[model samples]
Target: MKSLVLLFATTLLLLSGLKSQESSNISLIPQPVSVARGTGFYQLKDPLIISAPPQNDSVKFVANFLSNRLVNTKGGWVSTEFSESAGKAPIRLQLLPKEDNEIGKEGYHLSVSEENGVLITANTSTGLFYGVQTLLQLLPTAAAGHTVVEGVQWQIPAVTIKDYPRFKWRGMLMDVARHFFTKEQVKQFIDNMATFKFNMLHLHLSDDQAWRVEIKRLPRLTEVGAWRAERTGRWGEFTKPSPDEPKTYGGFYTHDDIKELVKYAAERNVTILPEIDVPGHSLAAIAAYPNLTCTPGTYQVSSGERIMVWDKGTFYALQDNNLCPINERVYSFLDTVFTEIAELFPFQYIHMGGDECYKGFWEKNKQVQAFMKKQGLKDANELQSYFVKRVEKIIQSKGKRLMGWDEILHGGLPPDATVMSWQGMKGGIEAAKQGHQVVMSPNSYAYLDLYQGDPIAEPPTYSMVRLSKAYEFDPMPPGVDSSLILGGQCNLWAERLHTMRHAEYMLWPRALAISESIWSQPAAKNWNSFISKVEHQFNRFDAASINYSRSMYDPIFKAGKDSNDSLQITLSTEIEGLDIFYSFDEMFPDQFYPKYTTPLSVPKGAANLRVVTYRNGKPVGKQIKMPVIELKKRAGIKVKETP
Candidate 1:
């Protein structure tokens, strides 16, 4: 009799452990403000009914979206149309007739129970959409797969989550200029970003490398500038294209494409902000219409080749790319561009790229020099400022606002122009101090193109921005008016990303950290908590077959010299519970190899260092090999470049 009692008790303990595990998994990204995890699960049954309060088409769309996604992803029989009865397995999407003070504009209150099914309520349809996103996340990761998932007992843990974004602007910049991404690819990007609650998309439509959007009034902009000779390899190191090479490696979006995209993004609650680069980075534009430049000479659109030469570390332009700031025709040309742009994109802010304006061509032009002296412009900065002011007026004429890079503040800040600080926080802070709006996108903290892990383990880029740095960013820097600051985003430049998969790989996981920084309360953020959620997110990405970087799990190499003046390599990781194994010999290292317990000093004639990470005696990270010569370079020692 005692043995029977013991067996029953043991069974109960195992069941309780399973329930506890289910109760603990509230790993939603952009961590919600409040969460109450409960025991048991809301096991989904067939004939699931998604009920909603009768309302506008947007609200209906939200309800239909949930049902359609379930059917598409899970291959389940789902029916929409709910009632006051709230029958078995009822998922209710409620848009409150009155506002819930706690659940403000983009926030929602979500509650789930095994007994009552699911209840998602919000003050607006957008909030309802967000609540649905969280609801979807609560399901098994495989439920998100592109192909229909079979034999899944669709279930969600019973929980109560109240969530909202901390900032009004959560954005991502897709640079389609350096390398054009198709309209469909951009749509896929929008879908991914909306999952993380990013509300804005900055479309970089023009650059020296290529033009990515159609200008109906300027046919040559697409006919001549939209195509470029094929050139691959490093962005700034590729050789010049020969005359025999055909310009057939690029494409542009038509006006109809923009309209379709704008509508599609709006449905996902994403606003598209179009960018038209000017003054600088205009080689493609000048290549199309040579008269637009200060020195109107025939030029071809850059083929991803080096157009700037480095003199000791500083860069100087080798071509005339900047728009002629003093030419009347330039303003006329811009007026036409802005007119079409303002009509195509409904977003209030238009980004007039004022970054990297090379003044050499302007300074050398006799006409620009004459105009500057006549206007008493002190320097090239003032001349550029003059150009910016005129562009501002042009933008204003279209019933829009001008947004430019922080460089616009050089000679003087444009009144009412929003500054996007890319160089660092100084420009953003300065702009906010001057009572102008600012979006903090410093390359140091928010450039997605930067390497997210050790250089040896990741693709080549000029520098690194580990996941920790992205999470640790403070969008609301001290000493600036919090009201003037308009949140932040990560800029993903595509000079090296030739494929959509590569772009996606460089974007996510790190973007997840940025989302949390911008959306969650500062105090609510805990790196330990966020990283765990990130691991769970990987499961979802896998199910969706979307590419993402696991760089966080890889070892970060730091080089230094020991007291004996010998080379020393220090290794660490971003996530916890991993054992690092490394080797000094050429052989590959695994869990059985030497465990990393301390910094290692280079032994004599050790040519290569191999490293890998393991958890529970199994390899869990990529095997990375670092050559001794590369380590010397990281240690600030001069190493000969391999020709």
Candidate 2:
């Protein structure tokens, strides 16, 4: 009898362990505000039905979207019904008559149980759509696939969730001017961002490299400026375009394509903000009409690098790329561009590229100097300011607000211009103090193109911005009024990203971190929990055919000197759940190798050290080899031996 009791107790313990594991597996990205787990699971049935209250097109659209997604993934038709009895459907959407101001327009409540099946309620259609997103997240990962996922039981843990975004503008900026992405690729990007509750897509349509949008009146802009000579390898290593070289490696979006994308993003509640970079990054525009530039001559569309020459002090001096502010035709050209831009993008703000204007040309131009003197401008910054003010009036005439980079804040800010702070938090803080709205996109935290992991293992980039650092960023910096801060965005500059896959590999995981940082409350964030959720999201990404980097799983190697002046090698990772192993003598590491529990000293006379990371007893990531001399050199110690 005692033996039987012991066996029963052991069985219960095993079952309890399994249940706990199952609960942990339901990790959701950008975790909901509140979740109440129930005792039993809701087993989804075949011929599932989704229904919503009548006359709510948004709710109806959500139902149809889920139904079609289910049919595509699970190989079963799910019907949508619109009727008063819709509340009885397995999946139901409800819009509360009175809005709950606390939850706001984007918040929702979702409940799943055996008794009620699944029910999502919100004060608005946007809230209902968000609730549907949370509901889809609760389902099995296989449901994320586009094709049939066979042999998987569709089940959702019984739970109730209340979720909402913390900020209004959760955005991502894609620099399409440097490297254009296809319409389908942009749509796919929108789909992925929508899953994380992002609502704004800032399309960088024009820059020094190329112009990526078609304006009906400015045919030469696309015909002459949209194409550039093919340049591969490092961004700044390209040779200047020769007269004989064919400009053949760029593309632009037509008006119809923009309209189609606008409609598609609207269905997902994403607003497209178009940027026509002006004044500074206007080489492409000048290439189309040389008269627009201060120095009028033939200009070729740049491949990927800026024109620079070494000054007397050895600092790189940039050549003139600014539009001729003294010319009356410049304002007319800008008016035409803004008119077409305002028609294409319905977003309120148009980003006027005001950063990196080489003031040398303005100071050198005799006409510009005379205009500055006539206008009582003290310096080149004020001249740029004068230009910005005129552009602001032009943008205002088109019924849109003007936005620009932090450089616009140099001499004097435009009255109604919004500032995108890319250099650091200082510009944002200053802007908010001045009672102007600011978007905090500091490069230290929000530059997604930077290497996220070990620079040696990841793609070459000028700087590093790890996942943890991005997660730790708070858009509303201290001393700044939160009301003036318009949330933040991650920028993906495509100077090095030649393909969509490369862009994807650089975006995700880091983008996931940024989403949670912008959406979730500060106190609710825990790094370990977020890492676990990231691991869970990898499965969904795989099912959805989304490419993402696994660099977080790789070990980050550091070298430092000990008190004895000997070099010590330290290994760590941004995420947990990985076992680090190391081997001396340049051999590959295995599970049997010395498990790294603490920093290891470089062995005397050792030539090299090898490290590998493993998860769940399986080897993951490439074997990292560091020569002993390199380690010593990194530790600031003299290398005894040369490689």
Candidate 3:
């Protein structure tokens, strides 16, 4: 009881002191480039204003926002000098490029100085628009009661700012094959990537569930794999039939659709990397061309129940699984498939599915063993390595690089091959140590298919990894050279994710948190600070009508109450401006604006205290799981007998 009293007192003191210091401790510096607590705000002081004459409405509008942020102080001015003759101007502002002007074509760039005014330019309207976003970040945050318009506030600061990204390959990966997303949805994703300054999107187009891209040479590849009659069972158990099966599900992109998406992504400076699995996740291939298998037998559209050792569809027969008798027909089939891939995707790197190839087939086949002896291959695992090497040569000969799951590293990876680390950092670490580039997408952090929260609330998957864990990830493990870390990706493999809503449910707000991890510097990261940003971002998602998991906010924000008398809660979601309302008596909550403080109070004798999140006078999105709280205090005081 005595210890409990002391602990309560300590917590109360700490929270009180933090609250007192909150305002004064806020840095007076221009924009805080660190993790945004709630919303990232910028304030301007003096000698920074946009005074340039108006060109297009977009240019002028963007300039106005920048001027407001850089001149956020009580009195300051920023002028944009827009003219054909930018003579003797300290800063020159231009609009969408005319064939001759080169300032804004690629994206937005803002050059600022304490002595001179700020100049901003972009090649397109959107570029200038993004420059404004950067300028706002460079300014100062608004004080209490400042009005916000369209998610931006005018709190400008005076200073010189020069900023840009360090690497050109900042990227993320999305798998639409497990569950197909429409072209429009893909474009929406491109827009989302643009908001965070991410520059690449690796699309895992082909998987065992479905094949997405259209290959003209092999029409059935798309006809059979691109669309499935009905999806298989859940991730772990593939016994029961899918209850909500679509009679005919799946779709593929036409050549024109691909071209449009390519142009769209290029406009946003995002390169699309596509993956086509081979050798093993080849049930899709066999279904399309039964002749590709060693047995040359009939194959069905995979029900997610693949034969581990041998099947009529796979190269190794059920009983005669071995590499001894090298199959001439299988090689020819693979050659044609690779040739088609080389023609379809212009990306330098191509993913060949090299994971989960069961060795049981080879162990049983005497012909395979005989061929292995003939070729002097040591063991079955070594044979898999040889298989990968052969494919690597095929991809390399056509001027492309081969990328595979870290499983490819099992037998022995070719020097030229790259690996996507999914199991853990071990594959990436080994690959980098051997002078090969690696993309870290470890499942502990990057697997988005796993429930972002408790399975009781959100149905379960094979993994229990959460969203906050994803945000806390550091791509390069300690002691590993960062040079070998090419980039990172959050993989959304669809096993339970059957529909587009399920896809969005698994991705959103979580992917938003990950965007900062990949783009922002390490020192700028803070779990608490990010939650504040998400509060407002949640409103943004609502405004966009994106259907995401409601339970995801718990761990990311740590919103539950402690056993102490008061609610010692932490707002972990990145949304800003959330009004937290709570009630100990369970009647309803007393509203608190921007409720990111600790140890909230509930009415006396309150049995339960629950909080609801709101934005802008309305419930922003789904209500979170209320944390269990108690109102008991210490029992240390003793009464005299006379009393």
Kindly list the per-residue Cα lDDT of model 1 for residues 1-643, writing each as its tens digit: 9999999999999999987788657788888899898867888887788988664678778889899888887776887884444445479888776898877988999999989889998999899999998898898887677768777878889999999888888989999999989889999999998888999999999999988888999999999899998877778878787766799989999999999999999999999999999889999998899988878567998987878765764667998888989889999999999999999999999999998887887888788888999999989999999999999999999999999999999899889899999988999998999999999998989999999988777888887898999999778999878999899988999989999999989998889999999999898899998888988999999998899998888888889888867788999888889999998888899877899989988888788999999988988889999898998987987777879
TM-scores, all models, native as reference: 0.96, 0.95, 0.67
Count of steric clashes across candidates, in order: 0, 0, 60
lDDT of 2 by residue, 367-475 (tens): 8899899999999989889999999999999999999999899899999999999988899899899999999899999999999887767777778888888898789
**Reference-based lDDT, residue 430, model 3:** 90
The residue ranges of model 1 lying beyond 4 angstroms of the native Cα positions read 1-16, 82-89, 309-314, 636-643
lDDT of each: 0.89, 0.86, 0.61
Q: Which is the better candidate, 2 or 3, if ranked by TM-score?
A: 2
For candidate 1, what is the total of clashing residue pairs?
0
- The pairs that clash in candidate 2 are none
Tens digits of lDDT, candidate 3, 251-334: 888767877887778655677887877666666666676665554455544454433433453533232112222566666655
* Residue 458 miss distance in model 3 (angstroms): 1.0
**TM-score ranking from best candidate downward:** 1, 2, 3
Report the candidate with higher lDDT, 1 versus 2.
Answer: 1
